[model samples]
Target: MKVTQRAKWRYQQVRQARRQIRYKFKPFKHTRVTRRALAAMVQRVVDQSQRYTLRAHKTRQDEYKIVINGWPDAVQVTVGVHSLSFLVMQHADFCDFLLWPDCMPRRKHGQWRCFDTGCLASGPYHRLEDLLFNHLAEPFLEFLTKVPEQAQLMLYDMEGMHHACVEAVKPLKRLDRPEHPVVCWPLPAGSDIV
Candidate 1:
């Protein structure tokens, strides 16, 4: 077989092996101490963020912006209410599921409120995961991967969300209008998750 084909086969074999290992030791890594420790670290890291002004005025999406870490260039991305914590949960896919305690959304009288921390009281949220995987995450990843060089995605979702953790960066355009970030949060009508 060709070298490229052989490499592909090897990659598949490695992926399968990893999946099996994860399935076997799935019960581990779930502990209160571990969760608190992780959260504390992430909170400290986020506190170090250099405040960047809100670019040209836009809606809440663009109005609230915090640039993600690890970009050599000054390409700014909108930091949705809980983007950091959300990214953390996404990255912790190594485990069965991420226990994000403070990522609850509160909707009161038809308004979606952003919760940075604390137990939220919201109801009738038919599309909870949809909002993240579809509205926020897809566009965020799209913008993150367009850079010339690979950048690191720091996630900050521990017990109470006190520390930021660096996550993976893959090349996949999940957004359409990279030039227009204000409209990127919602992504397109048929936005998808890879």
Candidate 2:
């Protein structure tokens, strides 16, 4: 083959390889082994006193099955869960703890989008945990203030990701919703959340 032809062939191969790498793995697809592995990894990291329990979903294996249950405060709440994927591509990880409140609406099956600025928290794994905690702390605490002591909270993590965009807010007369206690921290216009 001519030198130019050989070079062209190599370039095509490289392009195909790049494309395959880009789309090869869909991490959100939940398999039995993947769920078990995730549960074990999370158990290893969480504190023993936390008594975090891993509950597997009988169905919806494609979504996150194991939920990390623990108390962030006096209120017994779910700290977070191990899920695959992220809203932004910058800080994508093999697994992430999508914290409560943020993880609340995310668990529902429907069209999901992030209108809040603090959707994607970027940093190292530990720092990412801190960010997740900070994002959820206020809302969860307020929820505890309203929730009756006898009531139980089940923390479940779902594995579905959607890109976030800016949004305009309307007037709010009521701020309390027993089912939804989410507090959104809006990003400044054209803010860099990478």
Candidate 3:
């Protein structure tokens, strides 16, 4: 093959690889294992009572599962307090947690778009910031303050991850919902959580 032709082919291959890479739904903050573990924990909390879905890194770096129990298959879960509690941990996993799309958003230009951004950021499942920064800190705390005491939450690493989770959920405690103390098992440091 000609050298120029070979270069062109290589370029195409690289682009294709990137496209494929971006399609995968791996949340940046928590490892794949972390997502899986959380899913299992949530399942245990609610059990398989309702016909629900669990999509780890459903689109990107935000792990979320919409669990709905008690229903007529029609009028059930509301997108407010339940979701607020449900995503308490998930919101902490990534900088931006998108509740919309079934997939995570890929990068556009230089930044990621996210569901929480109100279209300020683009997202099917995009990010507001990199996983680390968001994991370390984010703007979700205010929402956490509004939660009720009976809300059911599952924490994997409370002490270690508490800095992020607590801060993120703090604001939600003030939201209109009951708080449900959780059974937390902090992940061992450096373990391959995913």
Best by the TM-score measure = 2
Task: Give residue 158's lDDT in candidate 1 (0 to 100).
Answer: 34
lDDT by residue (tens digit), candidate 2, 99-167: 245521121132222234456633223322333333444443333234333223222112333222222
TM-score of each: 0.21, 0.27, 0.20
Q: List, residue by residue over 24-70, the lDDT tens digit for candidate 1.
A: 11222324533343334333334433221112212352123333433
Candidate 1: stretches off by over 4 Å: 1-63, 80-125, 146-194
lDDT score of residue 47 within candidate 1: 44
Per-residue CA lDDT of model 3 for 45-96, tens digit only, reads 2332222222222333434333332211211111211122223233334222
lDDT of 1: 0.35
TM-score of model 2 vs. true structure? 0.27
* Residue 6, model 3: Cα distance from true site in angstroms: 27
Q: What lDDT is reached at residue 124 by model 3?
A: 29
Cα deviation at 23, candidate 2, in Å, is 11
